[model samples]
Target: MTFDAYDTWWWPYLFVLVAGWLASDIWRFIGVAIGGRLDEKSEGLVLARAVATALVAAVIGKLIVFPSGAVAETSLLVRIAAAAFGFGAYLASGKRVIAGIVVSEAILLTSMQLA
Candidate 1:
C-alpha cells in the first residue's frame, strides 16, 4: 500500500508506531519467552548477561569519549571528572544505580554551568 500525505496525515504516525513496536517489542517478547527456561548459570545466560553489560559499557564509553551536541562542547577532562565522581558516588552508595546517576548528572550539569 502506498502512503501519501494527502491520503491521511495520521498514516505516518500509525506506520511509525507499528514499525517501532515490531522492531523492538518482538525481541522483548521472544526474550521473555525463552529467558524463563534458561538456567541462571547456563553458558547462554552468562553470555547474554555479559553481552548486555558490554553494550551498556560501550554506550557509556562512547558518551564519555566521543560525546555529541552540547555535551561534546564540554572539556574532556571535565567530562572524565564527572564520570569519576559518578562512579565514586555509585561505589560509595552501596552500588545504588539511581544514586550514581543522580550524582553524576548533578556534577556534570554543575560543571557545565561553571564552565
Candidate 2:
C-alpha cells in the first residue's frame, strides 16, 4: 500500500518543518564544529565577512532601485530619500543598526502617508 502524504494538510506542514530544520540545522551544527578551529582574523574569514557585507549592500540597493509589492508603489525619490536619511541616521547614531532601521522605516511610512 502507498501512503499519500498530501492527502492530509498537517502532513505537508510537518514534512516541510522537519525537512527545513534538518536542511539548515545540519549545516549550522557542522559550522559550529568547524568554526571553532578557524581564526577570526584569517584571510578566509575576512573575505567571507566582506562578501556577506557586500551581499547585504547589494540587496538594499536592489530593493531601493527595483522594489516589489508595496515598496514598488512608492516613488523612486521617496525610496532614495529614505535610504539616504537612514544611512545618515546610522552615521549620526554611531553606526547603531537599530537606529538606521527605525529611521528608515519611519521615513518610508511618513512619506507614504504624506503622499
Candidate 3:
C-alpha cells in the first residue's frame, strides 16, 4: 500500500478541518449546556473575559510594536501611527470591539498598501 500526494499533503488539511471543528464544538456544547445562567455572571466568567481581552490586546500590541516576517519591514512609526488612528476610531465608536477590529484591519491594509 502506498500514499499519494493527497495522503501526504491534502489529508493533513482535511484532518485539521475535522479536528478543528470537533475541538471548537466541544466548547460550544459546554456553553450550550451551561445556558447563560448566573454562570455567565460569575467571577470566573468575568476573569476569563478580561484575560481573553488582555491576551488579544497583548498580541495586537506585539504585532504593531515588533512585527515579524514581511510586516517587520514596515516602519515602526507607521505601525504606531496606524494603531493610534485605529484606537481613536475605536474609542469614537463607543469602544465597540467589532469597530476596533475593523479599524485595526483597515489600518493594517492601508499600511500594507503603502509599504
**Highest lDDT model number:** 2
RMSD of each: 5.2, 5.7, 5.8
lDDT of 1 by residue, 5-25 (tens): 447878877777777667779
Q: Lowest-lDDT window of 10 residues in candidate 1?
A: 1-10
lDDT of each: 0.84, 0.86, 0.79
Candidate 1 Cα RMSD after full superposition onto the native fold (Å): 5.2
Residue 88 lDDT in candidate 2: 94
Clash totals in order: 0, 0, 0
Candidate 2: how large is its RMSD? 5.7
Off by over 4 Å in 1: 1-23, 29-36
Model 2, residue 51: what's the lDDT?
95
Quote each prediction's TM-score.
0.66, 0.66, 0.57
Model 3 C-alpha lDDT per residue in residues 1-115, reported as the tens digit of each score: 2233364667766666667777779878897997866666899889989998998999989988999898787788877877787778889999877787787668777878976
Q: lDDT value for candidate 2?
A: 0.86
Q: Could you tell me the lDDT of residue 96 within candidate 1?
A: 89
